[model samples]
Target: MRIAIVGGGISGLVAAYRLRTRLGADADIVVLDRAERLGGILYTGDVGGEPLDLGAEAFVGRRPEVPALLGELGLTDQLVTPAGRRPLVWAGGAAHPLPPRTLMGIPSDAETMRGLVDDDTLDRIAAEPDRALTWYPDGDQDVYSLVADRFGAQVAERSVDPLLGGVYAGSSRSIGVRAALPGLAAALDAGAPSLTHAVAAALPPPSDAPVFGGIRDGYRVLLDALADAAAARFVTATPATRLARASRGWVLDPLGLVDAVVLATPAPVTARLLRYVAPKAADAAAGIELSSSVVVALSLPQDTALPDNSGILVATGESLRAKAFTLSSRKWPHLAERETALVRASFGKFGDEAALSWSDADLIAAATEDLATVTGAVIDPVEAIVQRWPGGLAQYAVGHVDRIAEIESATAELDGIELAGAYLHGVGVPACVASGETAARRIAESLSAPAKS
Candidate 1:
């Protein structure tokens, strides 16, 4: 009845909680984490005498996982939405409204990209439908390649990179077409004549529902609830050194024998752990690269003359160190009540880990300077907090879908062993939650099945 869950991030926590529910109080579940605290990247820190998320502050509201989980936990009261302000893209040394009717910054028509890209690029976009397209049904390529070749490089770098950079902490050049924009990929695979037409087909239908949701007190509220409900033995500051098969089930290092084990860790760590048991899966995981990022939260005077927009996304080749700035006070109504305005400046991306080495003071200085540069506001911070996430995000590079398939197929026969993490299907909180719950359900079903005669 003993189960060992490795990695204490949201994925591992969700797995443990689901396991407790499926097996009841009698089942012994142990959650192990190398960090002193749980919740993985979903960390909430104190700033200006209040809670603020240092990692991911929000989730896609249209996705049912997060909102549904809150309801089940009776924490729906903590749910909150944005103030409905659109973000601006910082390009050509100025701010412009984010183009509408685009799929991840790929505009459906040339008119939408007006004022953002030059006349030549816009004209190219308008005439793209007449251009012949070559796409294989199952082939994949980087987003930059697809967009830059069809539209001009301006559309890929200025229009698309900002949005893709925010999502993957990587540029369009680093992200793949199929994994990041499946709908667009499908349209191309289905013989769309051009990129413009494919983008139009891929775009979701307009909806009144808010694009994102967040917890009022920060992600800590959700983390605390999951930990309490799981009621598992919490083992912190410990890593699972090795994993091997046992006579009856499996043997997880430090935790000893267990009926089941879930490796809800990052790709690199997961690869290292599965080296012997599932070498193919390990190799596949090892190929999945990671991206690092740093978040610097600054608290300023509430009356600071910042832009009314929710945030500012920096275009590629911008002269600033920050890739984006989330104006917390303007974006979230719950945070507007605070005496000081809140802003989050993000740094680093795939193949760029320089920010991780920056001192807290340096990061704060950069965030302040960059905020001033982007927002045209006075650069004075009442308080600041810096959090570094080394290899926090997994790059869904070209052929990522096939890599995931290889990993999953290789591990399908390993009974009592499961895998879950942000690297699997997606890097978002909702996807991680789904991955953990899936692993838990599989484990529960395997255990509940009758033994062979």
Candidate 2:
């Protein structure tokens, strides 16, 4: 049996790795990627002689998949938690501490969010418990609509937008609630009277375990380990442009016939690749929106005083062009050991493409300027590295859940074909890994089934 996995991102890599472990020695596996390098968005760059992640840096440790995978790769010891987990929000020309006991910016206790929201908004939030319960919408809805409806526009803009933007790199007003914040959606559907109370009820009891985990060096370490484990024929700089049905199974153009195929590319690319064979799935995949972003990593002088918080989430309507900033040195103790300070400034979102048009030098200048403004300290950077990810994040818009279901149902009719990636389910590293592994298992089962007799 031969299996061809398209795209060498975490999803593809994980899928290939799973196939290798589950299949027999007779099975042949190959991973095809368009880019020259593997790991896709999990890029780690060097700055001031220390490794820093340019793309996705951490995974939620609460998920068992990543930690289990790490153990399998002998990377359990390399897991490191953030030194400071609290992130501040830069709004109203100042950095305000993020309210505690909130789930993705949805405050559990209105009283705890005193300074975060204005007096009018605070009053509105405080009155939420007494407000009449509205029936949950039957269909999918955007996060901002649900949040703003319950908490008012101010809380939606100041709290929810920054947190959701930090995750999706898209507007909460546009991203779907069911796809992006499923727990909150479930709570709402259960007839929860208040958003705050619903979110509070959904959250698990506070524990000592760290919310997120990262590798000692970088996420690249995990990618390298996956590549090593898979030990498959890697075809870099060669993307599977077309996928079609063959006499026996599936055919990935230029890669020839394979018993199974795992499409691990982004939604847009996947749509194009699957168009000829599965038009319904392709069309549904094409409907999914994406957002672009740029991460500018700056190496500052050793003496540069940075915020003690993990990072600052730039609330919507802030004067700063950068959406957020991570005090890399402060957040990761491994980087703090280096002689210089490392900061990563994020720019661009769904509708914000102005920063993408700027040159590297211009982007650095703008990021640095925003850094100074938010940090309230004038500091010059010694070195800078800019990384642009066009269509970096998949925006789960309204009806995304239904669209994914339709795509899955369509793909189910096609033999020996499966889809997996960040676009399908959650966008985190763990979710991607789970999706890929699940796809691989499904393909393996289909391939091994007894002639369907």
Top candidate by lDDT: 1
Off by over 4 Å in 2: none
Predictions in order: lDDT: 0.94, 0.88
Model 2 lDDT tens row, 119-183 = 88888888888888675557778878877887788777888889888788987887888888788
What candidate 1 gets wrong by more than 4 Å, as runs, is none
Worst 10 residues of 2 by lDDT: 132-141
| Residue 187, model 1: Cα distance from true site in angstroms | 1.2
Best by TM-score: 1
Estimate, for each residue in 1-453, the C-alpha lDDT of model 1 and write its tens digit: 999999999999999999999999999999999999999988999998899999999999888999998999999999999999999999999999999899999999999999999999999999999999999887999999999999989999999999988889999999999999999989988889898888888888999999999999999999999999999999999999999999898988998999999999999999999999999999999999999999999999888999999999999988989999999999999999999999999999897779899999999999999889888889799999999999889999999999999999999999999999999999999999999999999999999999757
**Clashing residue pairs, backbone N/CA/C < 3 A, model 2:** none
Question: What's model 2's overall lDDT?
Answer: 0.88
